[model samples]
Target: MTFPQNEVRFEQLSTASPSVIYSIEEYPGRPARFDYLSPAFEEIYEIPVAKAMENAAIAFDTFHPDDLSGYQQAVIRSAKTMQPLQHEWRIITPSGKIKWVQANSRPERRQEGVLVWHGVMLDITDRKQTEAALRESEATKKQILKAIPDLIFWMSADGICLDSMPSNDAFQLFPDSGRVGKNLYTVLPPDLAEMRRQAVEKALQTGDVQVYEQRIMLHGGFYYEEVRVVGVGDDRVLVIVRNITSRKQAEIALQESEERFRSAFQDAPIGMALIGLDDRWLKVNPVLCNMFEYSEAELLTTRMFTMVHPEDRSILQQYIEQYLGQSQTKDKKATQVELRYQCKGGQIIWVRLNLSVVRDAQRHPSYYVAQIQDITQEHAVNRMKDEFISIVSHELRTPLTAIQGFLGLLNTGIYTNNPEKTQRMLKLAMDNGDRLVRLVNDILDLERLSSGKVQLAMTTCNASELMQQAVDSIHSIADQAAVTLAVVPTKAQVWAASDSIIQTLTNLLSNAIKFSPPQTTVTLSVQTQTDSVLFQVRDRGRGIPADKLESIFGRFQQVDVSDSRQKGGTGLGLAICQSIVQQHGGNIWVESTLGEGSTFYFTLPTPDP
Candidate 1:
């Protein structure tokens, strides 16, 4: 084909352009053919321009299969509208390389109802790849912001909220929708806003991250937040806020628990101490110091084993070793033992020591905790109980044995042959039976009074009448002992249980008469006092020892143990008397001297005259 001079100039100008310049003619009901192609067409589509011109379908074949349909439709629409066409599509070159291209063309209609397009096609694969990479980077940034629990903000240096990433409502101090385009002063409290403003200024000036913490009250709950402000250039800053409420609460709870433990350890009533593995006292409470008669400073300076009784130190050491060994295999149990401790004053005391090991995070024994309780008084009481049991057994057996023997003799024919002997035996049996009954009754009476189980009935009783009644009751016993009974009574009246007071007097008189020698005078007297009436029983006989005066009032206690058998005494009369006097809100005591007379005195509350 030959071109005109103007057409040749147009072709020459298009050849220098880095684009494929082409022309296509479409006839009605026929395939389209290329009228021209630039030299760049061979470089872009890997097809010769001569081949493309002869058959435009040769260039169309390079269109990617997926895009060819849309390309043809665009052409048809452009031709019908006679408008400029702008389209972008993918193409596969003859060399099997895929590329992106953009086409711009103008369409015209001829007189024969034919259509033609003059267009430029440019390779845009690099630009397409760059745009795709940018889109992927934007998507990844969004995902990262979504996963973070912190509320992030892009703000101007003046504390204005420029933009914010989406975050949980709990982290947002205010609704996210209204946060942008607002100043921090409007979004937060005055104090918090001031704090953030200062931090923002500091971060921008120093170009370093500024960190702080704040407590916020929202929805009637306290929230703790850790804030970080960092300058992001251009007079802007990035603010990160993280909720730290749970962590702050845990730390506060731990501190409170530690304080409570320390208070409890220091103020415990019983002795408490902390011991190191070497048996040294790491900490000692006031009670432990008082118990050992040592100061807290002194105790801490000394080892625990040194204060332990020599005999018990080895045992405590062994227990510690065993506990540590067991902890290595499994959970260890606390151990308790009763041991003796030597006080600072050289006094020995009994204590119940409870010991347990404290373990570290790795479950290794760290130290020990000890609780000590004084049990010295308990030991003394137990010893007294044992002695009382033995004395009572012997006292009961003596009377029961005599009664049994006397009754046996009377029942047997050996005593029946003599009526006088049988009657004597019968009398002996009756007397022994009476003694036994008195012993049991005295025991019951003392027990009831001591335990506060018996309530005494109080009444006004004349002192002289009480003395006469007691003397009359014990007159026969006094006569048998060859002791003279004397009464120097007064008209004093006492507020007491009449029956119980009379019993008390009778017991005192009986005891005096029993201890008196032949022809000794036993005096019973009463004296009036300011608030009480004092009664006295005096005897001139073998007096009670000086040491026994106080102890003689105890149950089963006498100046001599043999008194229970030889003196026909149950050893409980004085104890019962003391209980009765005490129940009447009075006191009882004995004044005596060895080898001299003895006097027993007791008082009863006096009734108004």
Candidate 2:
């Protein structure tokens, strides 16, 4: 017989409801039984209604034997005492299926002494599945916490430790043990625990997450933590702790790097600054401040154009606008633009400016980076050099005019007693005069090169032919110095200015012959490579001093000043050679051993096919 199932029906009538109903009745000499089962129970137990009503024992037999006594106690207590029984038990159905059932039964005390049990079975499988998922998630969280190299704790709203996962013990990274189910204050110092409590309390009060940084004294050192506390529920909170001592150290390193940048910007040998849009001063370092004779505050108030000389301001502005526009289109290059800028002290400083553009995230112009160098000294030196060249030119011209006049008169037999003697005297005068003119021309050429006044016409030519021509031009000097001169070429073609390369070779060969001991050899050689060509002049002479080798190619710079006295020649030969080589996009340097020999080496670019 079945018990009434109206209350169960009312409780589970909704479509989303998961509760199932069943009716149980106990009869005399007949086992207690279910009279009816709801539709959901069929699916829950995988049982058929007809078989369960036919034999009640079919369901009871498959219960786990260990739990049978508990189930029996619950049913018997409900029958004898007329109380409700609430218990969970496993049942096997005729379909050979096992299920968990939570049964609540009530016994009606009546004259017949029959017991009736009525209850609903909720398909709590999904609930059990949710519980299992929660358990797994908690276990995974604990595993992750334990795997971390840092200490972690979860504190309740009242500052109680609900749970904690301490790190591994290999290094005893987390010193605390016995962490769970204790008050937070019990485990920490009063001050640190109070700080954490306040942070959590603040998060609770505001209902917003809070993050804080804290330092704790640990095993012989301090540990820095970046803590984030969030309210998980009305009465609970979650805390995440990350050890940030290394990150703090890294921040300190970054600070040091910024200090270096600031120092370099302020005290650089060259004038440097950060200029923003609209010509405003974003920053002016010490060098730049001094260059403009303005304090940082003053520079911030003044526009960048204020420092430009009046005569050059228009051109400077035009270039600035052009650069800003072009910088918007592509990668900004460090550009060199020479202009005149007036100092606050009214001095017009000749400056060579190298500027770079810094852009914003959207690729818009942000600011300008300027590197300015004062070139007044170089300009003055160039002027002095020009004057020296003019003086030399005048001296050579006077002598050449007199020599030509005397030679012409002697050839006409004017006031000449011995024609052959006059002719020899005139020839000797002509030779010395030509030497003087050559010396003056060399000095002038050097002056022009040093001042960047000479223009080059560059091209690719035969290296062998150039070397041969250089050898021919210097053969007379080699013979005069009693030195053997030779030309050797490893490659046929090289790229360079023909006239400049010849001049360079002539200077090298002349220096070799002038410095060589009698009967020594002077060799000119050319070596070619994939990208460039190397030309060398080697002389067995008193080689350059080791310390003075670098300056030997500078204008008026010589290895031995007394060499000029003995040689009676201008000291601009090597310097001119160096300038010419550089203009051809090459380099010139010397390698030598004292008293053994000196080799002057120059390189020119290889011909591009």
Candidate 3:
């Protein structure tokens, strides 16, 4: 009954074990009997240790209904072979609760027909629950990987692509470049592959995640990737590459926009500057710097007031004060001021300055953008316009006075006393009326030509025919003037408006005849060139001065005031001819020497064959 020291230790350890030590003896009359059961039966199986020892049926009742057959078969097989039995199965406790237990035992057959099994049952329910949770977490991780659009790769330390997620794989930068088991260097450019290799090495060496951006050309377009590399294990790294092409393109576009603004600022035809609230130059463009003959560095250091002329300085100061006193706003009309600025050469120049307030994100006024345009020539043109109006009014009133006087005499009974006097008065009135009509017509034609409103009926006409028609039309007038009419015949064809060309020729021929001495020749001629035809009217008359030759083509211009009145010249003939010929893609000019003959020339383009 007494045991050795080591044997007693083993018995004490087995009794204290967190498992139940059990034995079942098999017989032919019944299934089995529990000859021995450990004290763990009460706490683990919710059964009294003594009651389970009363019959092996207590242990049999604990077997889960579904696992009962497997448990029975395992016990039978182990008993037949007298081998160790190991099985994990479910057990139903006395309290109607299910417990997962692992039954490990050995089987032995003693004397005839007496088969016994001694087993140890340990509660394994917690382990089973933990395993189930692990499996579920792994499944969830796989789903997340599938749902994400980021391209992920498992790359070996040597830069080979070991695996990729999202099995379609076409979203990869090198889709058709043979992915799995292929080295990245084989598909990517040498520099990019080296960059990726460096990223992997960094992750592995530092044991920290590495993030970088890469620009690549793929699928016939530019692509940008924000790549993150993390070491998963010794031989592989996880790479998550997200497409950032849109963000990259936005950055590029912003840079280009900034560059364009800078270019416009530097190359603008008018001066532009950024001025601080204190009326100091913050930034001045090249044009502004050039206008003041100051370098950019110097201008930024100088105050805007210093550049204004002495008399204009007060005006600028008042406006600046007014602008500063007003509330800062947006969508408000810019204020424009005309002022004078003295240049480096000591000359005062007039400038029209327009200023707008620039705002910050919070809508507070940041600075003022000023555009300055030189208006010296514009002011001079205004003065000339005033003088031109006065001269026109005088000219018009003179003709009006003559017409009114003659018509008044005829309208009243003053001329009714005699038919001869009445007829003569009627003729004088008609002459004045005709001159007024001619003046009005000339003004309207000049206005229409200047406004670009006239639509010319362009066609190809024989130059010889145009000249002969002008001659025939002016023949009687030519006879009255006693100027001989002649023509230098030409067969060249030209592209022009028929009516406009004929009118230009007739005007030139009439002017020629009117200016020529009686018995002198007024010649109409056409000369053919490689690409166009030249029409000329030459007259043997007191020629124009060299200076007047050019001015005679101006609207209402006259070579001689006395001559214009004597020859009934409108002075608009040459200007009309110039406009018509120039509209046909040609040029017109007059060449003359004082006291000699004059030749007026105009060219018309030839039509394509």
Candidate 1 residue lDDT tens string, 1-609: 446987888878888878988878899888899877889888888988888888878888888889988988998889878889889899888778999999999998887988888899999999999999999999998889878888888899888999988767665665578889999999899999999999999999999999999999988998888999999996999998988888888888989999899889989999999999888899988998999999998888898888889999888778767767776778667878888999999999999888888889988778889999988998889888888788778778877888889887667778656989888877888888888998999888888999999899888888899889888998898888899999995888999888888899998888888788899899989888899988988988788877888999999888888887678788899999999999999999989876788999999999866
Highest lDDT scorer = 1
Sorted by lDDT, highest first, which candidate order results? 1, 3, 2
Question: What TM-score would each prediction reach against the true structure?
Answer: 0.76, 0.49, 0.58
Of the candidates numbered 1 and 3, which has the greater lDDT value? 1
Q: Which ten residues in a row are the worst by lDDT in model 3?
A: 168-177
TM-score, predicted candidate 1 vs. hidden true structure = 0.76
- 1-609, model 3: which lDDT tens digit per residue? 456987788668777988988887887677688867777767788988888778667777888889999987887788778889999889888778888999888877778788778888889999998998999999999888877667887999999998888543455554433577889888679998899999999999988999999989877888998889999988789988877788899999999999999989888999999999788999889888877788899889988888898899888877765765674543457778999898777778889998878888887778889999888789788877786576567656767887788778778877677999878776777776777777778777776876789988888899888888888999999999888999887889999888888888999888888878899999888888999898888998888888787888876678776665677766677888888888889999999866788999988999998
lDDT (Cα) of model 1:
0.87
How displaced is residue 551 in candidate 1, in Å? 2.2
Provide the clashing-pair count of each candidate structure.
0, 0, 1
Cα lDDT tens digits, model 2, 1-609, are 234576555545732345556677787788878766666665666656567677767657767677799998878887777778888866665566555667665666535766667777664545666877999999998788778765556778998877665555443335556767778788778987888899889988888888888787877887677878888777777776777888887887899999999888987998887877777788877777777777878888888788788888888887887877777679667777778888777788888887788888898777788888888788788887797667566556655776877777777876577868787767767776876767778877876876787677777799988888888987887898899988774656787779778888988888889989999899988787668888889999988888999988865567776675467556678878988888888998999999899999989988888
Which residue ranges in model 2 land beyond 4 Å of their true spot? 1-100, 105-150, 155-162, 166-210, 216-223, 228-239, 313-333, 360-365, 408-609
Better of 1 and 2 by lDDT: 1
RMSD to the true structure for each prediction, in A, is: 5.6, 19.7, 8.9
Assess each prediction's global lDDT (C-alpha) against the native.
Answer: 0.87, 0.77, 0.83
Which pairs of residues have clashing backbones in candidate 2?
A: none
Q: With candidate 1 superimposed using the best TM-score fit, by how many Å does residue 384's alpha carbon deviate from the native?
A: 2.1
- Which residue pairs collide, candidate 3? 34-56
